[model samples]
Each structure stands twice: as structure tokens, then as C-alpha cells.
Target: MTITVGEIKYTNAFPFFYYVDRNKLLEKDCHFLIQTPATLNREMKAGRIQVGPISSFAYAENVDEFVLMPNLSVSANGPVGSIFLYTKRPLEELEGSRIALTTTSATSVHLLKILLKQYVEVNVTYDEMDPSFDEMMQDHDGCLLIGDEAIVTSWREEVETYRYDLGELWKEYTGTSMTFAVFAVRKDAIARQRAILEELYTAFVLSKEKNRKEQYASMIRHIQKGMGGTTAFWNHYFSNLVYDFHTQQQKGLLLFYEKAYEEGFLPKPIESIKIWGDVRTHHSSLM
Candidate 1:
């Protein structure tokens, strides 16, 4: 049976799929469904796709239905240039003010809430809406943007806005890395197509390595054909966006879930993160 995969169609997730497309590994055996993170989150929950990189917050809520892909994630150590909070005033001064958040983000919304509540100690009202800075700022004091939009907006120096990087904020608050997204597969999908899933996992690891070796420059140039931002900006942006769920990232993810649980962002308690297979021993090529 063919494996259907849901992929986040953004620059942050490009590294994971770049090598797969370059090598044509899934040309016949795989089907890809690409969309924004929010759409993929909803579709995955509806059982429309077998696997995808989902928001860390989404994984915590669906722990029983999903298991994570080992050693793969969209994370950042300190300043992730992709997730930002653009505001007219400082974060501390935004108490009781209105903040428009990107509806496309699952983790960022909760991250912002945690920062505002626990760190900033402010009581600001938040509304989730489309990620348009102009429209969002028209009615709100601040707005959160994730992925490509946030990257693009941060470069707009003439917008007269203060850009707060959520990843930086989380690190400052918790002193650990932040994992925005995690690769996850539905539990039943794993049970039914274990071999195919293993192959895909290998492909993912290989793609991540290809990205680290600077082989993705050509692919990034191709995607930049019509996109904003210069090649240098894109290069630096992707460089800061990391892709491994190692010890530090794993700790960050669990800490995020714990904070979310304490802050009531997650409805249930998450004792530990789950993995699909033994990542360390399952790196052999399945091609």
C-alpha cells in the first residue's frame, strides 16, 4: 500500500522533504499532502494523512493516537527567526491590550500565552485570526506570526513594530531550546505499515543530513524564485531553524508540555514523549 504523508509546506520544513524530492525516493510508493501547519494539524487529527510534522502542542493532546518520529523536529536553540510577535509597544506594557494571533500556529499561540501569563505577568486578550500583520495590527495592539510570514515581517524595518522572537522568549524564560514541531505518525498507521514507516524514517534522517551538508542551497534558491527576502536572509533563516530531536530538544519539548499543562494549555497530562522506533539503532538504509 502507498504511504500518504502530510507535510508542512513552509521553509522551516523544507529540509525534511528536500532530499526526498531530490532523490525521488517516494516517487511511486508515497503520496504527499502539503499545506499550512494548522490545516495539516486538523487533517491529521481527522485521519486524512498517515504521517506529518505536527505542532508539539498538537502531539501532546493526541498522545494516544500518535507516536513521534525519532530524532526529527522543527526546533531552535535561542532565536528562531520564524516565529515572532510584532507589536507597537513592549511586551510588558501590553497588559489588558488586544493581541491578534496567527490561527495557523498551535504551539506558538500557547507559547505566547505562557510568556504573557507566566513571564510577563500580563493579562492581555488574545484573538486567533489570519496571519496578516496589517489587518491584525489594525485592530489589535500586537500580533503573532509564524513560519514564512514571521520571517518576512521581521525584515520590515519601516513597519515601526517591535519584533519579539518567541523562541528567544522561551529560552530566556526556561533556559532551554524550543521545539515548535515534531514528526508524528498515527498509531494505527504504524501498526498497519511498520516497514513503510521505517523506510520513511530513514529518508527523513538522510534528508536532514543533506541539509546540514549545505546541499540544500540549490533547493532554497529554487523556492526563492518568487518569495520575498534575499538569498542571504533565507540562508541565515534556514540555518537557524534546526531539525534534530536530540537530548536538548527532547528536554525542551517535555518542558514545553509541562508548562502548557501547568498553564492549562493542554487538557491532559503528558508524562513522557513517545517514539515510533529505536532511532539510534534504526538508521540503516531501507532503500
Candidate 2:
């Protein structure tokens, strides 16, 4: 049987899929496809892709259909280079402000809304805007950008922008490590191809180690070719973007889901979201 794996074209997700594609790590029948986060979520929801990295919100939104793998996630504590809230006014001062959102990033957008409602206690308007930072900054009170677009820009000087780092905000509010994205496999897929999934997980662990030691050169090369940015920019991103497969971060994720539930962002409270394998015994190669 063939497994269609959906992966996001982001630096954090690169190490997970890159090694498999480059080395042909899977069985001959198994295949993978690289896609944007939105596309990945769509395909996964439709049961088209058997396994992949996906938005945290997608997993939360469809918790019944998938199970998390041990020791793999896209997360950072202070500043996740790819996800940011750019605004002319401070988050606290943005009362009745119109915030522009990138339609592609459901996780960040929902996160921003939850934060604003909880902390700011302000009623704000949300509108879909162009993904371009400059364009969104022109009309909206603030804009949320993700992926390569957020990485390349100088938000500090370019515009009168108040940066709200979502990851940092989450840490402050929850007192737990934040998990932005996770490696999840469909229930049916895991049941049918347990061995293949285990092998894929092992490959990810190996690649994570090699990626850390080598400063993610191969992943960087792939991103740089598509995203026009300086080495310094990419360096800052790589340095800050952490790849850790730890069960410890589960606390933060649970808290996020709790808050989302309280705020009515999720339809119901998820009692528990467990990692598939034994996290205690799984040794990650991430250095």
C-alpha cells in the first residue's frame, strides 16, 4: 500500500521530510508530497494523506482522526521567526482596531484573536489581507504574517510595528512550552502501516540530529532558493527556530487547547492529546 505524506514547505518542517525524500527512506510503494500548510490540512482532513506535519489548530480541530508521534514538533519559546503579529499600535492599545490576517495561517490568526480577547479585552475587527507585509501594514491596524514572509522582513525599523510574538505570549500565559506544529498520522494509516510509520519516525529522528549539527544547511539551501533573503536573515531564523521532539512541550499544548476551549475557539475541551509512542524511551537526534 502507498502512503501519501503531506509536508509543509517551511524550514522547521524541512528536516522531517527532506531526509526521507532525499534518501528514499520509505518503501517503494510509499510516496510523499510537499505542500503549503493550508493544503496539507485540507488533504489530511480529506483522508488523502496518510501522514504529515500539520498546523496545531488543525490537529486540535480534528483531534479524533489523528494521533501525535513521539518527540517531534515545530515550536519555539520566545520568538518563532515565521509567526508574528505586526501592528502600528501596541496590542494592549488596539481597542476597536482592525487587524489584517493572512488567510493561510489559521493557527496564528486564531491565536492572535484568543490573546487579544483574553488580555486586551478589546473588540477588534478581522479582515483578510494580502500576504505582503507592506501592503497589509498600509491599511490594517495590524497584520499577522507567517512562514518565509515573516522571516525576511525587518519589522523593527521598516514600519511603526508593535511585534507580538505568539510563542512568547503563549509561554507567558501558560507557563509551558509551546508546540506550533506536530507530526501526526491518521488512525487508519497507523493501523495499516505501523512498521513503515516507525521507520519514518526513526528517519526524522536521525535527520533532526544531522540538521542541528550542520546548521540545517540542506534545508536552508532549499528555502533560500525559493525565498529571496540574505544569509544573516536565514541565520537568525535558524538560530531561533528550534526543533525538539519532547513530551515536555505537551504541557504548553494542553494549556493552549484549554484556553482555546474556554474562549470557545474549540467546539469542546479535549481531555488529553497523547503522543503515539513511548516518549520516555524514544531518543531524539536533535542537538
Candidate 3:
């Protein structure tokens, strides 16, 4: 079975996909489609690809069709450096302000909305545009940015702006971590591709273990060569993230879905999250 994998083309996602056992996939080729989170979300939803890390909000949109892979997610406890809101005014004063939401991610966009409406209690106008910091700032009071673009641009230090890290803010308001992306497989594809998917899932688990232990240094170095951040900075950045999706992460995700629904952004309330595996996690792996 030729399996198609959607890879989120972001520095924060590299650890989980970098060390896959491609040569061991039952002699079938593994095709990779590396793109932004929004694109992967669409591709997975359309069944064009078997599995990938999709925006958390996108998964909630079509939860019935996707079964989450065990213990795999792009999540963070606090201060995820890659998702930021650069504003000229304070959070309290941003009511009725035009905010530029990045088109590259659905989860971040919705997360921002949840934060603003539910937590901050401010209603702001949102405009979706490409993640261009300069152009976005021209017409909006603030702009939301995520993934590599936000990572590379240190808007907090370079400019005199009010910077908010969504992850940190979520923790402050909700008192829990936030999950941005999840690894999911189409529910229909489960019966046919079970073996291959199990192997792939194990490989991903091993990769996350190895990376979290000592392998991420190399990833950070490579990202530095291309993305241009100090090794220390990159280390600090990735340290804030958690790859394994366990009970806490699931609760956080459900809370997000709840907020999205309450804010009228999510279509319906999701009572529970569905995982492919029976257990919550394969918790320990070379940690």
C-alpha cells in the first residue's frame, strides 16, 4: 500500500517526522506532502492523504471522519514562541480593532478568537491575510502569526509592540496546556492500512523519543542554518512544546473545542476526542 503523509512544513513539527523508518514500510513507498498546517488540514479532510498533523480546529470540524493516532500531537504548556500576536495597543484596548489573522493556520486563528471573545472579553474585527508582518500591521491594530514566520521574526524584541504568546496566554486563562495540531488518519482507511499505520506510528513514537532526548540539537542546528535563530534561542523555543498527547492534552483540546463552540466559532460541541489506539499514550520512550 502506497501511503501518503502530509508533513506540516514548520520547524516545530520536524522532530516527529524527521526520523521515520521509510525503508521498513512493507516495501511500499512513503510519499510526503510538506505544506502549511492549513493545507494539511484540507488535504487530510478531503482524504487526499492518509495521515498528518492537522490544525486542531480542523480536526474538530470533521471529527467523525478522523481517528487520532496515539500520543502524537503538536502541543505546548507555555510560551510557544512560534504563535504570536503583535499589537500596538494593550489587550484591554483592542476592542473593535482590526486584527490580521494569519491564513496559514486555522487553529491559531480560532484560538485567537477564543482568547479575545471568551477570555479577554473584547470583540475585535478579524481580517485574514497572508502572514506578512509589515503589510499586515499597516491596516490592523495587531496581526496574528504562527509557525516558521513567527519564529523567525522576533517582533517582540525588534519593535515597540505588545507581544502575546497565545500558548502562554491560554495557560494563564484556562490553566492548562494547549494543543495546536494532531496526527490523524481517515477512519475509513483504518481497516485496510492498519499494519502500515501501526508501524508508522511506532516509528513516529521512537522518533519523538530520540529527538526529545538528544536529537533535537541537530534539528535546531539545521533550522538555525535555514531559519537563522541562535541555538540557545531555538533550544528555548522547542523546550516549551510537548509532543505526546495524553489525558491532560486531551482535556485541553476538549476545552478548546468547548470554547470554540461557546464563542460560536466551532459548529458543535465535541463531548469527547477519539483516538485510534485504546490507551491514552505510550508515555515513556527514552525520556
How does each model score on lDDT?
Answer: 0.85, 0.76, 0.85
RMSD of 1: 2.2
Which candidate tops lDDT? 3
lDDT of 2 at 199: 68
How do the residues 1-287 of candidate 3 rate in per-residue lDDT, one tens digit apiece?
67888889998889986677555543566677899999998898888899888998998998989989888999998888899999999999999999999999999999999899889999999999999898999999999999988976673376778889999999999999899999988988778876666666777887888889994987787777786877788788888889989999999999999989987887789999988865233432222
| Ranking of predictions according to TM-score | 3, 1, 2
Residues 1-287 of candidate 2 have per-residue lDDT tens digits of: 78777778766577766655533544346677787677788899899998878888889988999998877888877677778888888777899899889867767878888878986688899998758888887788888888766766653364656777787777676566677788888988877887667767777777777788888777777777887666777777777766775656777778778888898889988778856854222442322
Whole-model lDDT, model 1: 0.85
Worst 10 residues of 2 by lDDT: 278-287
Clash pairs, candidate 3, are none
How accurate locally is residue 19 in candidate 1, as Cα lDDT from 0 to 100? 68
Which candidate would rank higher by lDDT, 1 or 2?
A: 1
Model 3: residues with Cα > 4 Å off, grouped in runs: 21-27, 155-157, 278-287
Worst 10 residues of 1 by lDDT: 278-287
How far residue 211's Cα lies from its native spot in candidate 3, in Å, is: 0.6
